[model samples]
Target: MSYAIGSVSSQDLWTRLKEQFSTVSRTSIFQMKSNLQTIKKRSDNVSQYLQKIKEARDYLSAAMVHFADEDIVILALIGLPPEYNTFQCMIRGRENVISLKEFRSQLLAEERIVETHVPNPLLSAMVADHSSATKGSTSPFQNNSSPSSFFSGGNRQFNHTKQKGRGKFNQGVKFNRQS
Candidate 1:
């Protein structure tokens, strides 16, 4: 009876060690497979996000280009030619793009039109929930604070009576006034 019990115990230990060895040997391979799956899923998600971002940027840039042009954009916002017609900004070059910091000063120089308007009821409720997820913001338009500032100048003084066309001297851009 004692010999039978010893034999059974020895078999159990050997069986346990064999199972443990198998588990240990396979661990790194299984872990690598899991990690690869996770990495593939994350890569797919990032690709999707980047594609969406590119589309949005293309559309936004088209709109900004129309606005940046001397004639079409400023007129749409401020209203009428030959009055503010002479008041064009030289957005053609790359060098003079205004800083976001200076944007505050520029808008402040205008009226406080950059201040967020209360969104319509449907829009307002959406803003309320998502607003907490971000920093202190409540409007869709209030976050980036770009060309909105340019629209703030309410009562513009049209001192010059130039031609109702592109550039004060668009052809002779060199002579056109810059301040």
Candidate 2:
């Protein structure tokens, strides 16, 4: 008896494939296909980018909160290049800040500031003074341009530093003026 092996037709092959698919449960195949489709899904949600932007915006807002009206006046006075030693001055018991708009006007009155600029020392003095607890008004310097005034003797911010006292009282110095 001779067996016809290669004589199996294309129809027989299709039947074998159909029988295999039928043996496998349709519900399990559908669940696996759905799972694969879900895993392969791509979306345009920029979650990471949005999170980064939120973090940057939060940092910017925090920086803004640190800036106040006093900071504007301070920057106007001292400029941003040099360091403001307000914290250090407070440690030395000096309590002052270039916070008064009136004070800026007073310097402008003496033509010390070029009608436009206040130096950094004034801001440094103001920052240092702000850190200290004061008991009395720090305004003796406002009385007159005396040799012993804290901010007097004209606008020291614009004065020539005569070598007579190079570092004694050329610029904004602190003094506990007693009445």
Candidate 3:
């Protein structure tokens, strides 16, 4: 240790060591910023996305680029995929500026709602003409019920059969054409 100190001053040695082992670099900061901008929820849950945002924010802070809470919130929203487009619009349209805590809570709540949503199978039930099925005659709107039902024909009685494994009971929806 004495021999090493005789060759170099402590200040010069410290500087050399710091130069070689420093964690902060211009390229790393730029990459962190780029990562923050391009991050998406994708397969990650709301909590995981938030954690990534926090990590990037922390990295920026460590690099001496301090960001406000609102800026972080905006960055998080920007990183979200198009699936959250309506939610993003709603948040942006609010009269009062939302805080980071409030935004996180709201986002988590929305994520839970999206995850729990079970599509109603009744909406896509097939419409079979009661008359055609009884008398063995093919009708214009028989076998399928699509959005085009509105333009198909006049008012008719049709049986709504739920697709197999979708539901057990069959229901009826009145098909009405508007003038």
**Which one is best on TM-score?**
3
lDDT head-to-head 1 vs 3, winner: 3
lDDT of 1 by residue, 103-141 (tens): 324423332332343447987766765565345544434
Selected candidate, larger TM-score, 1 vs 2:
2
| Residue-by-residue lDDT tens digits, candidate 2, 23-132 | 54556555543432232102212233223333333333333322343443433333212222342243225255554355345433433223245568978777676445
lDDT of 3 at 126: 30
Which residue pairs of candidate 1 clash?
A: none
Rank by lDDT (best first): 3, 2, 1
TM-score of each: 0.15, 0.18, 0.56
lDDT by residue for model 3 (1-179), tens? 22235436778776654554366788988888898878888889999999999988876875677888888888888888776887899898999889988999999988987788786665434334444434656554566745356444445544665556633433464346799
Model 1: lDDT equals 0.38
Candidate with best lDDT: 3
List candidate 3 stretches off by more than 4 Å: 1-23, 120-150, 153-179
Q: Model 1 segments beyond 4 Å from truth?
A: 1-105, 109-111, 128-179
